[model samples]
Target: MPRIKPLPDELDPLAAQLVVRLRELKTHGELTMRRLAAGTGYSARSWERYLGGTSLPPRAAVEALARLTGTDPVRLLAMHEIAAASWDIRRAESPGEHEPEEQRRSEDEKGERREQEREQGQPPRRLPHIALTAGVLALTVAFMAALLLVLRLDENVAPAAVATPAGTAATTPPHSYLCRIARTDGRWSAGINNGRDTEISYGDTGTDVAEAQCLLRRAGISPGGIDGMFGPLTLRAVKTFQDRAGLVVDGMLGPRSWKALRG
Candidate 1:
């Protein structure tokens, strides 16, 4: 078994927790990445990324681990959901990124509202009445500041396992953890790397062809062996895999076929 890499410290606290728990369960089950791949249909390399926190594990991976380790799927799945949600929110909140168009529009609307008030002479009236309105404005600002502070504190902390309603927390549902994978940018980390789209056919031999062969073999259509050669056996294997993958059954490996093979 390969040595496990340390979980990334920079991961969102919730995601870090999920990865740590997965590592504990994987160790408790005494299953190597190879055995896990054999049992779960995910590649050992995929498990490496997932457990190392370099990539988020798919829902199927989570469920498989829960089943193997006898952990409460409901709770683990909730953690997975919260972790995934944090990943998305972090990406959205990346510093110095372009402001969302909707938010930009919202700012413009606020400016327009302020301008309208000014044109209506409200500013003048408010200026003359500042002594009366000052206390109200100060109180409003203080309240908003306190509210923002609390919200920011919440953002910095990891969410609890249960939801609080009526001041009581209950376990979250497993389905609540269900979510879509991050954008197309996350595909490579998800084991769906489609970097090279060269047309690979018979006699085309290299790392690219070998990867295709590996994916084919994993799908139970052996390409003779992973010798990095696109020989006759490899061609037949590609066609067979394409057929099963609902592809065009072309002997050549292209983008669509590569996507199917990786997935």
Candidate 2:
């Protein structure tokens, strides 16, 4: 019998999740690092590093594990996503790039001294009231100009005519389809609609749904495989989504309420 290698001590939350998953698989006799190494032609040391959270596993390693364990690669990939996002957030919050309190205070003092020198060298500046009034006038003019420009642009940009589905009277409220929705453009847009038009903003759809589902899963709603489908799994996902979006617990996807979710 081969001994299972231990994970690294510095593992982040994501790495820790992976370790938990691996341990579950081990209990189920689904995989062992030595077995995985033999199957994938990777060294046991490489397997240890990949599973230990010291390094990201190659896509091939993930695929191989899925095959060996009788698990969906897509689901495994989703797990990796959670880990990566957690790592990114941790990196952003780390104090490595922050200035010390003394350094920040010194910089602030230097800026104040420079402003004082400029004030002493120059003639008394115009009254702040006059300056503020002029600034407001300039901003109003600029806003008017921008409004006109936007109106002109709208005129040039043709709108797509989404014809109502046949036999569905335009006067009747648009048939409410069950969908798994997520926030986009400060509105809640559907992630999964039953083979209908689910218009998510470009560069927003897949990644956002994956992230939202990841959060929902942590909150105890299983969103299936995060494949952006509005099926039963995603409907289960909506209860959690609604709670986070501050909507009534009802699962119906109404336009006004869904719009609030896009935030």
Candidate 3:
């Protein structure tokens, strides 16, 4: 059994859990990295990165591991969903840090053209002033539309915490949610939170997270502290409950996971 490296301290919590679970599965099957690479059709270096928490493993790679270990792929796939969302969030938050190769190539080409223009004593092409004004107007309209959509969603979903006005330096604190767990018809319900199918995951902060945390405690899995924040501990508790209840362990509180948690 190859020793796995410690996960990065700054790794997304959900992604960290996925890597830990993958490591556990690897150890349970007594499979070496090289063996996993060969069986999964991925390079050993790739497996190292995946298991080491430096990279998110592809769904195909995870499925291949399940196949080789004779384990059900459904649970692993559920975990993948959470990890994938975390990976996407990281990428979105640091777009410039991980620019795509094609985008880099395009930028380089533009830079080269600008250098050539300078060498030839020609001014670089610029957009027309009218075009720029039109673009600004379009952007303003789009922003307004997006703001309206967000307001509509907030009205429909749940009450939102007060937001800081645009161009303000002050930040508003996140809302604190309390769990009001109650037993009704042999099932559990959070009286304050009423969404039966709302999907909550790591980084979510609301009554829904509090509701899941309350149910997780009811299931005898502590979600760390029920602070209404769906952090790493909540994710682990969710996966544990999912595994015990024979539900997919994707770590997200989806419809099926919600059903299991409620039941």
Candidate 4:
């Protein structure tokens, strides 16, 4: 797998969410940029721009990635919509390179229309239309802003899982891990990853997290699902297990937790 560069630090939070999920999907599929390009019908350079957080990806590209990874595209598509909306909002708030030119064109058009109306001895007939348009636009923008705010707050609390046709929504992704617990050399193993002593906490991610999740499940605790993401539920599970096993209940998985998990 190619080493993915870190995303730009100034990226919007909503956009960051989509990009992170995309990176996770790529990791899960074990696909490089070239392979992803070949499979998804996008240029490797474009993929770099999208995955690097320099540019937002199109809806089609996002869906293509989901298909290539053999994952359902619904959640990805919803995320894309939020990212795109957030991008549009940010762009509208910022001045664009073409703003000056567009403003000049708009002024010239208004001047010409005024001159024509003056010559025809007609009063400005566009006032009502412009007022109505502006009012509608203002309302739309306000509603979108409110919606985005609510979504951000909800996401911070709990990430919503997309429901599939066959089942209800779940806290984890559809993919699941099959625990292959076994004893080897007097140490326990779950066959997900040989990651002893790897420190993991909330917001951490990778196969190691997945391994911990698998072990937690085998020990009769739920880590919210083996989706490779260490979120709040996973942290709670770790703490619960630690308390039960008479270890430090710091909720940080380290060597002791790993040993206990493996044991």
Best by lDDT: 4
Q: In candidate 2, what are the lDDT values of residues 1-263, reduced to their tens digit?
A: 45556665656755576556655554454455665677567788887766665666655666556544434444444455455555544444443423433354455775787699798896533434766557655654554454344334442243333244486333211112234545455644444432232333212334444544444554566765554333334554566667777887565445533444444
Model 4 lDDT, residue 171, Cα? 28
Lowest lDDT sum, 10 consecutive residues, model 2, at 169-178
TM-score against native, each model? 0.37, 0.32, 0.38, 0.41
Q: Which ten residues in a row have the lowest lDDT in candidate 4?
A: 95-104
A best-first ranking of the candidates according to their TM-score comes to 4, 3, 1, 2
Best by TM-score: 4
Q: Model 3 residue 5 lDDT?
A: 72
Model 3, poorest ten-residue lDDT window?
154-163
Task: List residue ranges in candidate 3 displaced over 4 A.
Answer: 99-263
Candidate 1 overall lDDT versus native = 0.63
Query: How close to the true structure is residue 9 of candidate 4, measured as C-alpha lDDT?
Result: 75
Candidate 4, residue 198: the lDDT equals 84
User: Per-residue lDDT of 92-166 in model 3, one digit per residue for the tens?
Assistant: 445544454334556477579779879999963444577655765565455445434443442224334434348
Clashing pairs in 2: 183-262, 187-262, 188-262
Candidate 2 versus the native: TM-score? Answer: 0.32
TM-score for predicted model 1 compared with the true structure: 0.37
lDDT of 4 at 118: 94
Name the lDDT value of residue 124 in candidate 4: 36
For residues 43-86, write the lDDT of model 1, one tens digit per residue. 99889878888778976788767644434555566667667766
